[model samples]
Target: MSFQSLQLAPELDQALATLQFSVPTPIQQQSIPLVLEGHDLLATAQTGTGKTAAFMLPILHRLLKEPEHNGKVRALVLAPTRELAQQVAANSEAYAQYTGLKVACIYGGANISPQEKALKAGVDVVVATPGRLLDHLLKGTLKLDKVSHLVFDEADRMLDMGFIGEIKRIMRHLPEQRQTLLFSATLDEQVQKLAAQWLAKPQRVGVDPENSAAEKVEQLFYAVDDDRKRELMSHLIGKNNWQQVLIFTRTKNMADEYAKELNKDGLPTLAIHGDKSQGARDKALAQFKSGKTRVLVATDVAARGIDIVDLNYVINAQLPFVAEDYIHRIGRTGRAGKAGMALSLVSIDEQWLLEELEVLLDERLTPQWLQGYEPDLTKVPKDNRKNSAKARKQRDKKHILGKRDQRRRKK
Candidate 1:
């Protein structure tokens, strides 16, 4: 029930106390003992469920007992994105502070020189994105042969981001006898197959069911035309006096556009996406987190990336193409058993996205219309051009053709 009961080393216990972590989350409680006993683990837990500490604490405890490998990474944590990798590294540093364990983080966007220097100098643990880590491994600058502990944090997202090949290549450099842990929010087919092929006799631990959102998250949908979504969101923020908000758009351009328009509406806003340099993204995140910016517009690149523990509001200005991503977007809020609000601005064209979420969550979702923001029924909204029957047929044709092209490539 408590961190003390986990029987962690005095240093770890004291670190947890300094961080004010009194109780272990469910995933932590179930996975820590098994990890300490040296079992490979497959844990199904969402990001904000304190899953980071669940695996990191025990791994730190074990690593503290061994002498640091001068140039070899003794413990490795693989993340999907730069943001996520940095977050894990931050936590690892905080937890390992008293234990004298050093941590290094490597990802694609930042300069690789510093990462290479860190690896050359030495670190007890390395948290990295698969692509950047693969680069290090290929260059012979980093070796994981001595790694006793490995963690796949957000396995599903890594796979979804098309990093499976890179992950597999990275794994080739690791020894088979090491302890492996795979953590995913959902045990989908891809993640399941990865677990089957990887973890050896792993203990399966789950504190939440598949595709389930946090219980305390208050979800609501606003039915407005696509064209007026920005207006509605600005109005809501201004009327409700929302100081901090995270809004998700479907594309990088949309993110930039939304940020621009919202700023024009007198709301301080910034956009972060793949197009931005890592420094710019980091600055944007800093501003948003520091409450200097009122709204942060982001693409799905940040759905699992941002780790604001006390974030109170999440808005889906545009629905994600993948229905399940709805869960990840809303997950930015309502973390760690905290009460939060997740609002989606749904348009006529995105009804399919909403429906898919319903099927995923196994529940019905009703969209509410604000009086002044409602789409004028008599007048056709511009979204009709994309959602019309003819448009649907065209989209279907493209999808079919794309699949045929994929099959042709396989041939």
Candidate 2:
């Protein structure tokens, strides 16, 4: 359905039209109306499902219709990472262009003076990371008394990053009577507890199954030696002529090292991790998005919240410890109804991680063996001392292959 059918303000309609947003995404169609009605909501949706706009459009409408209050933060959106906060702020600005909504993003990294000045000027909407936002609130620089809407975008991610305490602190400061909306890809036990505590009879909305990956993404895995994984990655990128590839590593050191190796192969590559300054991270993201950089290697934690819609490929150089992270890693591509591909380089040592990932996605990844780099089929996969029943259950439930020795011995 068209965005105009939502009965948005005239200015919001004009902004949507000028932005070429002809149709509303499914999440938007369901969420915009509820948010505009000022109800607390808990929305579970997968990544790349236009979840960002689900909250942005309604918040913009609310800010525009209400009269301006001086030096008061009317709307607050808390994201888990700096990149997510900036992305949310950018989307908020794009949709609120015609509404004269003053939106600003505050996060750690770079100078805080500018964010301080913006907060002092009375922003209608403020998107922020929890740590930095708490810093401002503690310093008595940001006033949230007037905030009628509070959003925890990526609530699951915040819990993963160990931000529960900070989020609780922020909740204490917010007015007791206000609308709270929580959006996440998955609502695990911890997330459910938070929702129970924060939301008051939240309207439940589910667009996609929890922890589901985008259907447009074609997933594959390559079985290779640990040392030869980079070679395979270089060959895959060059062989397929894949541009705008996002390569994920489990550690910061690996991200930096792999980027260098890919660069040596004549592929324009850069790395983003916690070690790099915010400026470097931003520059790397810009280059990757503009197609100037063909490959971007990043640690899973650092790249967790990146929002780049035109990414053509995703390569998991190393799998994450948490199976859920595998979903978000490949989600960088195949966004907004665009088809994309994800290639994961796996070695015998990483077999357990691969197994865990498969369990989360509920499907076995097809392993494409390269001609020259065939894996040693004789090597026994690592079971890591002893296998627990929980791990085996995860494997059986998801139909993950391999680890026959452990399963056979258990029987």
Candidate 3:
């Protein structure tokens, strides 16, 4: 359905029109009305599902309706990483442009003095990371007494990062009577516990099942030796002439090393990770986004906040340790309903990790061997092959039993 049917404010409707956002995504269609109705909400949707707008539009509308000038922070949005905070703040600014709302994004790894100044100047909405927001709160640079709306964007990620204590501390500062919204890519046990504690009789909205990647993403993997991963990646990019690619590595050092190797092979590349300063990270991101750098190598921590328009390729130079992160990594591509490709370069050592990812995805990923770079399967550890064979037999047995049961039912 069109966004107009959601009954957004006139100014918001104008903003949406200007942004060419006419149709609502599934998450937006289901959650916007519930949020506008003043109910606390618990939503689980995959990345690239327009979840930011689902909450931002309604929050901006509520702030405009109330018109609070006292400036004690009417709406607080807590993101897990600096990049995500910046993205949410950007979206908030765009959607609230016509309404004349003040938006400030605060996160660590940057100059906090300026953030403190912005908070002092007064803002209707504050999007911040948990650690940095707590710093401001403890330093008496910000207040949440007037906060009527609270949002935990990427709640699962925050919990994974061990920010649960910080989030709980931040919650203590907000007024007891408020509308709370928790948006997560997955509603696992940890997220459920957080919701139980925070939300007050919330409306549940789930657009897609947990651990599912975007339907438009074409997922495939290349089998190579650990030492040949970089060589294989370089060959694929050069052979395919990939213009803009976001590559995920498991560690900061790998991200830097991969970017350097790719650049040495005549590909303009940049690396972003936690070790880099905020200015450096921003510069690298801007370069990648502008196509000045054709490749951006990033670790899981640094990659959380990357939201680029038309980013068509996401390469897993190294598979994530957590299976769910595989979903988030590929999600960087296949955004805004566009077709995209997610390629993983799997080595012998990463076979176990790939198997875990397949279990989470509930489907087997067929492995492809590059013509010249095919891995030496004979060198794979005997134990690994044995385990793989055993797992395959179990799956075959289960499939045969299911088929037999279906035949019996028909008879």
Candidate 4:
């Protein structure tokens, strides 16, 4: 159904039409009506399912009818990362432009002075990262006492990034009586607990099955030795003629090293990580998104902020320790109903990570043996590597130990 059927205001309809968004995404289709009806919502959908607009539209509609008073924050959107906060702010601005709604963004890594100035000027909507917003609260620069609508975009990621404490702290500041919406790609037990604590009889809406990747993405894994991973990557990129590739490494140093190696091989490559200045990260991201650079190597932190359309491939140079991250990594490709590919080079050391990822996906990844890149069977695999079946058992062992340690620490 079209966005108009959701009973949005005429200005919002015009905004959607002007932006050429004629058809609503599945998440938007399911969640918009419930949000418009003034109910708290917990929605689970993949990253690129237009989940941002689902809540944004309804919030915009509410704001349009309400009067904006000085020092009153009507809507507050808490994002996990600076990039996400900026993105939400941009979306808010785009959707609210027609109604002349004022939007302000607050996040770390920029001048606090400017953000403080904006908050004092009184914006109708504030898109902020939890930590930075808390900073404003402590400094008496921002107030959430008047906030009537709240959104925790990327709720799972916020928890992963250790923002749970900040999120709970923010809750204390917000009026107990308000509309709360928590959206995530997946809702784990922790997220569920938060939902129980925060949302009031919320409507639970999930457009797709939990932790399912897009059908358009062709996922493949290559078995290669740790030493030969870089070689395999260069060969695959050359053989496949991949124009735009997003490569994920486990660490910042690895990202930089791989990018340098790829550049030396005549492929224009760049790396984005926490070590680099924000200016450098932004520049590299722009080049990669514009397709001016053929390869962009990034650590997990860098991956969260960079969004490119029609990205052809995502290469996992080093698998993530967290299983959910595997889903988000491949998600960078296959966005906006587009076909894409996710290729992973798994060394002997990362077999356990691989197994956990497979369990999370509920499907084993098909191993494709590339010619000349086959793993050596003669050598005993390192301690870090275990066969897929063994890996699951190992993970369980660790979990048991972790629980024991928690109890001991408490005692």
Candidate 5:
């Protein structure tokens, strides 16, 4: 159904029309009505599913309809990363353009003076990261006592990054009675616990099944030797002439080293991780988006909230230890109903990790070996080691039972 049937305000309807958002995504369609009705919501939807608009539209409508000009934060959005927080703020500004609302984004890895000034000058909506928001709170530069709407975007990622304590602390500063909305890619145990603790009688909405990857993405893996991964990646990218590639590495050093190696091979790449300054990260992202950089090498932390339009390729130079992160990484591609490709370079050491991912996805990923770059399978697999341990335990158990039987016979 169209957004008009969702009972949005006239201004919001006009904004949607101007922005060419005539149709509503499934999450938006299910969530907008409940949010407009003032119900607490816990929503699970895949990345790149228009979740930002799902909550932003309803909140902007409420603000415009009620017209709160109290010079205090009326809406507080907590995002896990600076990029996501900035994106949320940008979307809020775009949707509220006609409605005359003030939106500000606050996050770490940047100067706080400007954020302090913006808070002091007054803003209706504050999109912030937990650490930076806490800094503002401690400095008495921001107030949430008048907050009527609270949103936790990417709740799972926030918890994964160890922001539970910060989230709880931030919650203590909000009003006792308010509308709470939580949006996550997966409703794992931690997300469920957060919902139970914070959301009051929430309305649940899920667009896709839990932990399911995008249907349009072609998921493939190549088994290569650890030292030959970079070679295989370069071969695939060069042979396919793939542009706008996003590669994920497990560590900052690996990301940097791989980016350098790719650039040396004439790939024109840039790396982004925690070690990079905010300015550097933003510049790298800008370059990539502008097509100035062919590849972006990133760690999981730096890759969060990356919404590159028409990003067609995502290479897993190194698989994540956590299975859920694999979903998020590949999600960078196959957005907005576009076909994309997700390729993973798996080595012998990561076989167990791949197995764990397969269990999570409920499907086995058959590995394809590249010519001249095949993995050496001479070493014992981790599964075999586990099996040997299990055998030893079984033998000990039999011995103990035999001795007990002998004692019983003597008795």
Candidate 6:
């Protein structure tokens, strides 16, 4: 359906037409109306499904209709990561371009002075990460009593990142009388509980099934030895002449090491992770988006907000420990109805992960053996005593005890 049919304001209509957005996505079509009617909403949607615009457009419309009361914050959107926060802020700005509405993006890894200045300038909307937003609240740089529309974009990711406490703290500052929207890719038990607590007679919208991958993406699995997986990646990239690829690694060190080794072999690769400064991460992403970098190796958290249109390939250098994350990784590609490829290199040790993913996906995933990198089927996966779950728990206990002792000595 046409966006104009949604009864949006003239300003929003102009913005959509200027951006060449004539038709509303399914999620947008279902969500925009409920939000405009002042109903709390619990929406189940995936990335690249136009979910941002689903909530942003209606909020912008509502903000335009209601006169600002003392120029206080009228809307607040909380994202899981700084990158996702930036993405949502960008989209909000573009949507509010014609309406003269101001948006402030607050997050960590940068100077807080600038964010403080923006809040002092009086913004109509604030998009932020949970931790940094709390910092602003504690510093009295931001207030939320006037917030009429509250959004928890990617609620599942925020919970996965362990922001439950921060979210609860931030909620204590908001007015109970407001419109709330909770969007999640997966409506797991935790997400449902959050909805039950926050929403009041909400409209439930599910655009896609849970744990479902994009329909346009072609999924391929290859069995390669753990050590030879990198070689196989290089071979496939060169043989397929892939122009730009986003590869996901399991850890920060692995991302850095993969980029290093790939660049040493003349592949223009870059790595992005939490360890890098904000400026460095932005630069790497800009380079990759501009086609200057051939490949970008990243951890799951680091790759949260990457939205590359027409991105053809995504390589999972290593399978993720959590099966649901595989959906998030591949969702980066095959966006906006474009065809994409998700290639997973599974080693003998990681072969078990495939079973978990298959079970969640409700489909049997077929794996093919690469000619030269075939693994020994008879060999049992090696177990490292140091990396065992029990060992990790022990280390965590000792670390906590050490910190407690240090604090006691200081006191």
Report lDDT per candidate. Answer: 0.84, 0.84, 0.87, 0.83, 0.87, 0.87
| Candidate 4 vs. true structure, TM-score | 0.93
- Per-residue lDDT for 381-403 in model 1, tens only? 34444333432443444331112
lDDT of 2 by residue, 1-411 (tens): 788889998888888888888898888888989999998999988777888788888887888778778858889999998888888888889888888788999999879999999888778889999999999999998988888889999888888788999998998888988888999887677778889999999998978777777778888888898889899899988998988889999888999899999999999999999999999999998888888988999987678667777787999888776767777888888888898898888888777666666666676666778899999888876665343345647768764333322343453
lDDT of 3 by residue, 12-130 (tens): 99999999999999999999999999999999987888999999999998988895867668999999999999999999999998998899999999999999999998999999999
Across 246-359, the per-residue lDDT of candidate 5 in tens digits comes to: 999999999999998999899999999999999999999999999999999999989888897699999999988776789899989988778899999988877766765665
lDDT of 1: 0.84
The local lDDT score (0 to 100) that residue 97 gets in candidate 5 is: 83
Give the 10-residue window scoring lowest on summed lDDT in candidate 3. Answer: 399-408
lDDT of 5: 0.87
Clashing residue pair totals per candidate (backbone < 3 A): 0, 0, 0, 0, 0, 0
What residue pairs clash in candidate 1, if any at all?
none
Off by over 4 Å in 1: 378-411
- Compared with the true structure, model 6 gives a TM-score of 0.92
Candidate 2 accuracy as TM-score? 0.94
Per-candidate TM-scores read 0.92, 0.94, 0.93, 0.93, 0.92, 0.92
Estimate the TM-score for candidate 3: 0.93
Name the better of 1 and 2 by lDDT.
1
